[model samples]
Target: MIEEPGRVVAIEREAVWIEALDEAACPGCTASVGCGRWSFDWLETPRRRRRIRALSVMPLRVGDAVVVGIREDFLLRSTLAIYLLPLLGLFVCTIAIQQLGFGESLMIPAGFLGFVSVWAMVRRISRRQMNDPTLQPVVLRALPGASEGQVRQAAF
Candidate 1:
C-alpha cells in the first residue's frame, strides 16, 4: 500500500472528498528544458490536487487529515489497461486486417485506421474506468490521532 497524505476538503454522509498534496522533485541536469516533455510536466506540476471520494470509514470533519492508500495491483492493472491494451489492440487489428483479402494499398490504410479506432476505444474505456469508485484506489486507513490543525499542515 502506497500511502499519500491528503486533506479532507469535504465530508458528506457517505463519502469523503480529498485533495492530495503535491510532491516536487528537481530533474537534475538532464537538459530536458525546451523539450515537449519538460513543458508538459511544467504545465501539470502546479495542478496537483486529486479530488477523490472515499468510503466513509469514520465521522471525518472537513479539515481532517487522512491517508489514502493506492494498492500496487490497482496501479499495475490501470497502467496495463491504459498503455499496453492500446498497443495490443493495434497489433491485433493490424494482423486481422492483413488476413482479409484486400489489396496492399487498402490493407495498409485500413489497418492504420483500425489501429487508431481501437486506440480511441481503449482511451474511452480507460476514462470510464478511472471514474469508477471501485476502480479508484482504496483508503486502507486514516490517522484519527492527528489534530485538525496538524492534518491541515501535514506533508504528503
Candidate 2:
C-alpha cells in the first residue's frame, strides 16, 4: 500500500474527506544545472490543496489525523489509462484511415476524433470505477494520539 498522512476535514456517513498534509518536494539531482525546473522556480505556482474523499474504515472526527492508502497496482493502471490510451487511439485511428485509402488530409481529423472518443471512453470507465471500493483510497489507520474510544469502536 502507498500511504500518506492526512487530516480529516469532514465526515460524511461512510466517507471522510482528507486534506493532504505533505507537499511534494523536488528530487535532489546533481544535474540541476541543466534542468529547466531548477530555473523555473520563480515562475512556479503553489500547489492547490488536495482533498480526497476516502472510504472510512473506522469512526472518525473532522480533526482526526490518519493515514490514507491506495494499492500500488491501482496507481500504475490509472497512470497508463490516463496517458497512454489516448495516444494509442490516435495512432490506431490514423493507421486505419490510411489503410482505408482516405486522403492524407483526412488523417489528422480522423485521429483527433479517435482521441476524443477514447478520452470519453476513459472518462466513462473511471465513472464506473468510482463505485469500485478496491480502486478508491482507504483510511488505513488513525495516527497515534487518537481518543481511546475511537480505537475501541474500530476494534469491534
Candidate 3:
C-alpha cells in the first residue's frame, strides 16, 4: 500500500473528504553543497492542493488526521496505461502501414489515428471503472492524538 498523510476536511455518511498534506521538497542530489540547482529557485511554483474523497470504515470528523492509501498494483497499472499504451499503438500502426507499402507519407496520419483511437479506448475503460474500489484511494487509518471532541469543538 502507498500511504500519505491527510486531514479530513469534510464528512459524508460513509466517506471523508481529505486534503492531502504536501510533502517536503526532496533533498539535493550528490553534488548538493555546490549544486547550481538552487539558482533556478524562481522556476519553482506552488502547486494546487489535492483533495480526494475516500471510503472510511471508522467514524471520522472534519479536522481529523488520517492516513490515505491505494494499492501499488493499481498505481502501476494506471501509470503504464497512461504512458506506454499510446506509444505502443503509434509504433504498431506505423509498422503496419509500412508493411502494407502505403509509403512513408501515410505513416504520420496512421500513427496519429492509432494514438487517438487507443486514447479513446483507454478513456472509455477508465470511465467505466470510475467507481472501482481497486482504483480508488481508501482511508487506511486515523492518526493518533486527534480527539473527536477537539475536532467537534473546532468545527464550530
lDDT (C-alpha, whole model) for all candidates: 0.68, 0.79, 0.76
lDDT of 1 by residue, 1-156 (tens): 666667789877667888775543232436667556566767786646668777666777877778776777888877786678766766676677678765677766766776678778877877777666766655555767686445444423
**Highest lDDT model number:** 2
lDDT order, best first, reads: 2, 3, 1
How well does candidate 1 score on lDDT at residue 19? 77
Query: Which window of 10 residues has the lowest lDDT sum in candidate 3?
Result: 147-156
Candidate 2 wrong stretches, greater than 4 Å: 25-47, 145-156
Count of residue pairs whose backbone atoms collide, per candidate: 0, 0, 0
In angstroms, the error of model 3 at 21 is 2.7
| All candidates: CA RMSD (Å) | 4.9, 6.4, 6.3
**Can you give the TM-score per candidate against the true fold?**
0.65, 0.78, 0.78
Superposition error at 26 for model 1 (Å): 9.8
Task: Give candidate 3's TM-score.
Answer: 0.78
